[model samples]
Target: MYKLQLKPADKMPKYKQIVQSFIADIERGVLKDGAQLPTITELSGEYDLARDTVEKAYRELRERGFLTSVQGKGYYVQAHGDTKLKILLVFNKLSSYKKLIYYAFIEALGDQATVDLQIHHYNAHLFQEIIERSLGKYNYYVVMPHFTLATSQEEYLKVLELIPAEELVLLDKDIPELNRQVPGVFQDFNRDIGGALDALAKELERYPRMTMILPSDDNYPVEIDRGFRQFCRYNDKQVAVKDNATDEVLTPGTAYVVVRETDLVELVKKVRQTSYLLGREIGIITFNETPLKELLNMTVITTDFEQMGRTAAQLILEKKRIKVKNPFYTIRRGSL
Candidate 1:
């Protein structure tokens, strides 16, 4: 029989603590492979825990490949310490919002799985190389492909061919070429922008014109432009869509929608230099929320990144091969 200790003050349940202690002992060579474990009833009595709690812990250990049960016999250790699920997480870049997603994903997975996170920085060549190198190396591959406008769908499909579709979980943007073939958690960009604009329709009426500054160099989703146009046309509002704000003049009674952070900074600087009262003489709406944006009191259009992470983790854990459209909402601050 193995000696087990339970701490009543510990936040972890007695059964889970037993599981962790057993795993730790096994890793330390105290519990050798093929070693027999105490019976559930015996462990329950030893730890002063319920029989069901010990049984549940044993069942979890067996399911995680830490132990094996022999019919009409007893439970034995199947693995010394290799019981963690290996996951490969790939991202475009690590931004504040993406950090939220990554942390949420890690929290949702708990200690049952180990994740190796890598960033390709939106480089197509690096993306291809990383995916090819990671083939067959992980149990699951979660990819966030921020493909540029220049990259063709065929190029993406060819690179994705390296991984089995069942083992892949695409994140953020959705590719029409992949269609329903690959499982993913994607944002409905067009719907999100359009809905956000509609929600702010009453506030937008306060201004005579709205201008959307879209940088040509940035790889913003095309749906954003389409959604902006759709909202402007549908509402019969005068709107100007420009590639950059460099040449445009900032006029009072006009709202500016900026995408990139640098552009937001420039616009804010311009507003302050001219002494335009924010949310009154001129309005600002930025894409994606961050802590700094909150300090500026800027309204933002954003998707629930943490929820996206939790949903993605759940899908991977459940092995569900389905596409989920993440939720999006508008945060109203002093800017709007």
Candidate 2:
């Protein structure tokens, strides 16, 4: 049946319009397989289409295996068009976890989606610009709203409100101010780090003093420091915090909670050149997991990055509007 009007003002070309409309109907199941389409003559007459225009549209549909022609009866629907999602995946920065999240996301989506990945580099102005320019261009907007600027929370929330609530999904960082208006898969940095330390309390007894290498980078979450301090206070353990670890004073009986990979390398190199054994005299616990850390048998507290990506992809596919806390765990290895 004829479903689209002859909108001459539409920027889309006439034949393309006809092609797209049918494809949309097929994907939506409004047009079913074996269903008969109106005769080209009938469509042309009723919709004011040139005979060549209708014929060309039908030919394109048939070439795409979406239509079949009967010599006497006219055209009928062939195979149904699969629903293909066009998603805009936005992130703040490309860190080590980016690759894992990206690969897992695409692998889960498979042939059902076209993901357009973009980064706003944590600039508030750039973030707003990207969202504005991409408006109405994607079926879904998946974003990681991690900002480093001292801008008020209201500013960020206002920017997010620009996106339609139903079409938006958040990743990585969760904003409690949103009041559950949208769905997200995020990490509880404070609770996660604190809980990990509490879980390893017995193992930590080997070292009476503990120090955290927390660089003064805006990107490094402040919640991590809070969590560490909270855990130490509750456990009655001696604790210290330093901004740099390159020349850190490594005490003989103290354990270290290292944050940066660069810092970890420096500390490990420093330890290897000393008398303290790796797991006995001195202990190491890193923030995130890596192959090198695994090889060195270092304990780590990390979020399930691959699983986070898969969960985000599932949310997009199902168009779900529920919040999920990604799993976080401590991988106990020889270093601890």
Candidate 3:
């Protein structure tokens, strides 16, 4: 029989102490593979614990794959302390900014957890399939739901219900339907964009006209467009919104706000083709920061992705269920 000393004053429950003792013994070689563990009644009587308490501990151990139950016999040790926390990380797509968040999460988690990342590519079907297949496999599920404009809130919430709310964390954008039910680390898109424009108020005066190149295909949050429009209207700044840059002409004293890197490249090529010098005659403000953007002298409005990842990891480690709005700022590099 295994002996465990339980403290009545201790915060941990008696059953948990027993479970930890078993694990410690297994890891220290005091308990070996196929070692028989005392029955629930025996353990309960020996430790002065309720039979249900001992049974609960044994159930948890078996569920965690540390022990196996033999029919009409007894429970035996199956494995030691080799269980690694498995996390399922689902993203819309693998972008540079997201890569920053991913690496930061890995660094924060260290070797105690393992992450399996998957991209749904903004497809609702794929997202559903991934979530359904990952229901019970992962101990934790971190999801970035970048649903399309056509995807309904019902569709998203339906699939999201597949995972237990306590074991899930929403990432990047927070949906209104879910409210504050689950913990999330999200960017306040509207406030961030509005704040960035406010920070660049003096610089924006150099350009008489401000144009934003927002792609219609990508499922960008509607808050971005709303924020941009509200800022321009409130400040009385002339603003034009474009879906693409194929036919748009670059003009002096005009600033271009680009969302996609491909559009930024197209705009830069057009500016280079023209006689207007970069940053001086044609101002550019791109969303999301990267090292290459710094080299290109592109001013950016971005959120602290690293900090978001760190906060998410902390929430998971501490088992906190709260919504957090990550920090955002404007990085001016002479582009605007």
Best by lDDT: 3
Predicted candidate 3, C-alpha RMSD? 9.3
User: What lDDT would each prediction earn against the true structure?
Assistant: 0.83, 0.84, 0.85
The order by descending lDDT is 3, 2, 1
lDDT of 2 by residue, 151-199 (tens): 6677678889988887889998888888547888999889999999988
lDDT by residue for model 1 (179-210), tens? 34878899988889999999999888878788
Top-scoring candidate (TM-score): 3
Error of 3 at 300 (Å): 1.3
Number of clashing pairs, model 3?
A: 0
Error of 3 at 195 (Å): 0.5
Clash counts for all predictions = 0, 0, 0
- lDDT for model 3, on a 0 to 1 scale? 0.85
Model 1: which residue pairs collide?
none
Superposed Cα deviation of residue 177, candidate 3 (Å): 1.4
Angstrom error at residue 254, model 2 = 1.4
Candidate 3 per-residue lDDT over residues 1-336, each given as its tens digit: 676645577688877877777775565445678989999888888767899889988998998777999999999998655555678999999988899999999899888788999999988899998986565556689999888988888888888877778778999988768733999899988888999999998988888888999999988888899999888988887889899988888889988899989899899889889999777789999999877788898999989999999988888888898999999998888888
Query: Residue pairs in steric clash, candidate 3?
Result: none
